[model samples]
Target: MADYLLESLGLLLRWLHIVAAIAWIGESFYFVMLDRSLKPAADGDAAIAGEQWSVHGGGFYRKQKLVGAPAQMPADLHWSKWKAYTTWLSGFALLSLLYLSSPQMYLVDPGVNALGSDQAVLAAIALMVLAWLGYDLLCRLCGFREGLLGALVALWVIGLCLACTGLFAGRAAYLLVGAALGTIMAANVFFVIIPGQRRMVAALGRGEAVDPVPGLRGKQRSVHNTYFTLPVVFAMLSVHYATAYAHPHNAWVLILFMAAAALIRQFFVVWHSGKRAWGLLGVGSAILLATFAWLAPTRNATSAVTPNSAVAAPMHATELPAADTAEIQKIMKLHCTACHSAQPSLMASAPKDLRLDEAQQIERHAALIRRQVVDLRIMPPGNITSLSEAERLQIARWADTLAVDPAFK
Candidate 1:
């Protein structure tokens, strides 16, 4: 009952997080597009920087960007801060409920670094906090020099990626990086953008000359947030792609993926500004293709027949012996059924409804098992079930046999 309740809460939080993130990101993208698509004011008003005309829902609208505060403040100005706040709040709740609550199973990987559960949770939190502080400091120190600041931020991101992959389970590390980026985005809104807007509004209300510095700062942070959108979204979605996260060079993989996402986003940004940069798209596509080729598993490798035995060299799939179902069943019972059976002992329900209590069910998911258990080695997360290497190899051998058979293939 407790597990079920927790699962339900996680579901609710995830839903709320997604909805709020969509709202925030939609607003960000819309504004960025509108700004880029704007033309010079038709009447050449000194106070107006640019204006755009658009038709939506059978109505024509003209939007204007003022150089500074208008002569009079509007009575009911809408603020965009709440969506960002809601996204961060719901996302943090979900992170706490899922990863922090069971750090042993989700966050800490003994093979990577044997951090205690509490320590792992603290590290995750600290990463998000420190990321925001460091990024904010960099913005303050190098705000005038955009190129230098961009290089520094890139270095910082690479360092964080390396640190995360080294410290936690790969899946958790990816999610943590996403969370860190998300924190920085939300903080940009809370600490810089929103505050700057508020100050400008306050100044306008007081009949004081509105300072342009705050508005400039707000624009800078908003641009940063827009660039971060695709990368952060990719990182968040990467949990589903074990091939990327579980690779031997996962940090580099993550960095490359983010670079690709940023490049693709840059293409869109340029396009919105009445420019074409096909090279950006081409470069991003090349990176993705290279990464895909790199992550493809080498299937010709030999597997250990047992824990005490050694295979002297790699052997082809055809040369391998047929798998023993009884042995496979035993291994599954020991390592997988706890969380993957019809009545999972460790969770409210079998994850993804992949019950392996029956032979037919196990055989049905053989390819999936091989990918998760053998190729990626990301299942039984954090090695919580202590799945032995020999057992994994056995599963791999079985999967390889299936690959060679036409019916199974």
Candidate 2:
């Protein structure tokens, strides 16, 4: 696309996505904490299950709540539902704009399949839907709401990470996983959660007793959303560490990362719920993540070089002719360094960690470019980089022209 159009569209929706995400996540975190901190009402006289008092912005603020009826409903009760829904919507728009419609180079890994955009998109949607359906079913199972549910769901999520990441590129896998989570979240909101809340509201409107079961179901889904949040964030941002997605056994690495992200999230949840050191659960989760990481095949997190002073393989400067190197560098600086450089040095900015600053950096990342841009057309992002079709072909051809993975340890 023309730079003006790509830049214009990316700029606009990205801003909306950011604003919406802040609202969604901020509200989610606050409510989860609120519910957890709520205590049993002494004498059962409190109108709400929880009440909190805090000083913020240098003033004391007290909040009150209720299990259902508040004696009488407030004239103005703000609904926070749209924050989450809109955030997911904006994110979906961004995903489609940047990753779906553009060339396959940025999101597709030809290593998986040299697919046309139509086929790749179909695959992406199918996988995301499949993941959500599987997870929803797991939650709806007969015994899924009790003690074993958490463990079962966790394992099921792990299995999903392994299966889906195996079929797609690493960054693509990570993204689809995030998308799957978003879908589940939206489904939870629309199907189970919203309906349950509506039922409660209707009962209240009709002067009928609001049963706590709907509230409980809503709470269950909300908790699931909280547990799912961290890994979703991690997966959304994993494109930066191409290495994570580029590991030799890539799927296992995703499984490891997801587990690690979830474990870290759990720590916060338990801590916030006022159980600071639930040692057994915490330590057990820690060990589980550690075990997974130990099993992942890690390349140098940044470079192909080994930790030892000995190089992985001798450098072959002659293999890339000086002219070719200069041309490749020129192409990168012209088309990519804008948003992908060390400082990005272009526009207001791009996000972090996908920086490309030097020649060695470019060559070292040749396979990635080929996989993401050349073969998959997954980068230069939505053609926002204004990389021409010819340039795309050249870049891929250049990456493939390399004879071997000389940097492999």
Candidate with maximal lDDT = 1
- lDDT tens digits, residues 236-342, model 1? 99999887888768899999999999999999999999999999999999999998887766643444221111112344556555575566778899999999998
Which TM-score value belongs to model 1? 0.93
TM-score against native, each model: 0.93, 0.73
lDDT for each residue of candidate 2 in 1-409, tens digit (9 for 90 to 100): 3655766887798899778877788888888887777666655655567777778998997666775576677678776688778877888888787777653645555545566678778877787788778877877783334667888777777776775566565677777778888788877887788888889888888899889877787788888888788778877787776556555455666666666666677777777778875664566477666755554432333322222211132223333222254577788888888777766654444444565658787787777765556443446653545676556556644664553544321
Q: Which regions of candidate 1 fall more than 4 Å away from where they truly are?
A: 301-323, 402-409
- lDDT: worst 10-residue window of model 1: 304-313
- Candidate 1, after superposition: displacement of residue 9 in Å? 1.4
Q: Which stretches of candidate 2 lie over 4 Å from their true place?
A: 40-47, 278-409
